[model samples]
Target: MKTIVFKALPFDKTLLTLALESGVDAVLTSADKVEAVRALGRVRVLTPEELPSLALDSKTDEEEAVRRLKAGEQLALAKGWEIIPVENILAQVPDVALEVESLDRARLAAGILERGADVLVVLPEAAKELKAIVREVKLSQGTIPLVPAVVTEIRHAGLGHRVCVDTISMLKRGQGMLVGDSSAFTFLVHAETESNPYVAARPFRVNAGAVHAYCSLPGDKTCYLEELSAGRDVLVVDASGETSIATVGRLKVEVRPMLLITAKAGERTGHVFLQNAETIRLTKPGGEPVSVVTLREGDEVLVRTDEAGRHFGMRIREDIKEG
Candidate 1:
């Protein structure tokens, strides 16, 4: 995850509050103000004196920055630092924090080397842009390529435990969770972002899947629905495969009628057991969601393909298979 550090220098209470509300990872302020910042919220507070400073004005300065980074000290690059030196330092060390004075610079710093810097120090002058920066750099989880798969089978699975993931974030129409029996071929299960006559919209929830199923998570990790709990992070993907992190506010596991959905994308085939209800939906190739109850054989839906191997929820290379 990318870190967003707010430069709360000169003790601006509003800026500190903004940082706290924006979910910034840390606040850089004077030593005396650290406690006050903590009083506002739980975040890392860094004093200028505690961080090794670097001004990449010359070859010697760049070397010092690289040396300090190698020595395990998190060096904060001074503003006006050139991209080449930052890139050079990033190539050698992954913990270097770049001080960005504007949203543009923050975007540039994040896109460096295509992996971005480990941390960004948003200067006080850019406080107004802090929210935007945090949203773009911190909330965005990039994208995944989604493909159309043909539904090969649908069976009425016996009543079993189903997990309804209630997230703290309100989801949009195209947003949902990816879940399946195997992590290698999870289906895009749409969220309850649509309102019907029988039930009002519960935009914060996704009637995900069976307790034993794999739900796609951030950093390419997967966790079983039974393993999810309040405060855990889950990756929410849209029809276009754009992803963002959502905090799990609650998990509802109940005995509900389930349907076994099997789909095939190319030669790969996989299945997921989901609640058999009209509100439970799988996303179609064009982004519209089709209810699980209405899902039929030959219907095309979006599914993600991957290597079908997981050990303790983490992807691993081994001779492993799952039905």
Candidate 2:
């Protein structure tokens, strides 16, 4: 079993699911506890003091600092986690002149790399500089994973959307990497691509697809469905919360503000088709009969079902309805 290092527990269920699917062998514990080793299967725990080459700068908003630390702890709890003591990790790192700006981050990151740091932590503000250092190490024919410390917020829990995008971007560096965050699970549902060339080092797979997808079609991503035609897979996701429908298959594509439904028309009457001059409806317990609207000659409607409940007919209206 290969060893994988992490600075925090994977709080985001999506990323956690992806990591499990991708075959990561172990998680670096925050406590550096022996029990974590047994729990993670193939594991080796390291303390932060073990590395001497790296340093950490404690400069940031108090709220952000606490947020990042909590995220790390949450990651540990999700996986068999232990602490990587700062003292131990830094001791083994080959000491270098500390830069005034990122003196601490450089030391910590460099120390971990020298001491086999599979996943090194960096402050969010230092993310750009961390990337630069990773590049330098790669130039020397070295490969190491530099994990960023992201400060999460209630508005954007689980590191929200940006972190996943960042992880995908870093995978292009071709190094064994892991992201430790409380919110890593958020994007797991919607991030669908496995083994993306963008980040080939660690091809992580999450159970969920990313709410946002890379659109091959032109124009702003928000307008992807505006000009598209119907009867194809128009993937739509909920960027709002955990409870909402994460992804819904848009059945058809027509003129602006119009749609066609293609999935199951109803649960009792699986796969009903509707093509009318104006509107269509489905008959289901507690379900609104009129499922679609604005149907001209060649329009379609799709319905989907989930564990929560059954959904009927797709909305093909041209006008945006008020919330």
Candidate 3:
């Protein structure tokens, strides 16, 4: 959830169109050109009065920046400002904006305090690297630590409700959703990106697991499979733990024979009940899919472990346990 704004002041139509095509969150333009910018695309257009730009060179200026931010105002910092003053303002609030003239400066602004600034104003001079700036700074996410877990048990769980997650974005072979009975330990369920003799490949779908299981989402949140619906965002994680956000296009819930898979990793045991079929798969250690039907007790697969407490999809601090 990072906000990227392209500064279109002085109103260059080419750069405005480029910003729109680059998927910028907002376009900062003059009041006279707001209508023209809106006519081009459906983007948030801001005038100078709406999001004023300033420079923080002295203590008084830094105090003014801090005061404006504390008063619930969002302003942009001019380029050539020092990092210490920005950090001082950021320590108190998280909504301070920074103007950058290059992709490197944008990355630096985004990595401030390890959480980045709430808003990034892109100058028109950086038009050549706008797409790269958005891709690397906005769409990219953090990585998680994935470990090998040995399969302990695989049993027929009989006819049960399962969920199929259909995302708007096409997923690759090693990317899928992480689901399990416990958030602390979850299995990397592979997407249906492989074509078999019987069925065609579904690069947009993941036969995730049972409807009651917990599936990881962005911002370190989790939700049950049954609760996922169209227009919702789910976290798509690869075997290496790199993550991205995918919008749900549809959800399929059906009664299919399920297999309860149990795996153990360093004394921690986790379970994920998935549909019993050849197409249903889990990711292997080398970033390949291993079908559930072909899985054996000794096989090793990729699994993720994290802090377990969650209430209503948000992480919490409490003494709670799940099987």
TM-score of each model, paired residue for residue: 0.96, 0.18, 0.96
**What are the Cα lDDT values of the candidates?**
0.90, 0.25, 0.91
Question: How many backbone collisions does model 2 have?
Answer: 69
TM-score of candidate 1 against the unseen true structure: 0.96
| Tens-digit per-residue lDDT, 149-192, candidate 2 | 11121111132121112122211111111111111111112232
Count clashing residue pairs per candidate.
0, 69, 0
The candidate that wins on TM-score is 1
List candidate 1 segments past 4 Å from native. none
Measured with C-alpha atoms, the lDDT of residue 62 in candidate 2 is: 27
lDDT (Cα) of model 2 = 0.25
Give stretches of model 2 more than 4 Å off.
Answer: 1-4, 9-26, 32-37, 47-119, 122-323
lDDT of candidate 1 over 1-323, digit per residue (tens): 89888888889898788778878988888888889988988888889887745778998999999888898877789999888988888888858788899999999989998888888999889888888998888888899999999999999999999999999999998889999998899999999988899999999999999999999988889989999999999999999999999999999999999899999999999999999889999999889989988888999999999898888888899998888
Model 1 CA RMSD to the hidden true structure, in angstroms: 1.3
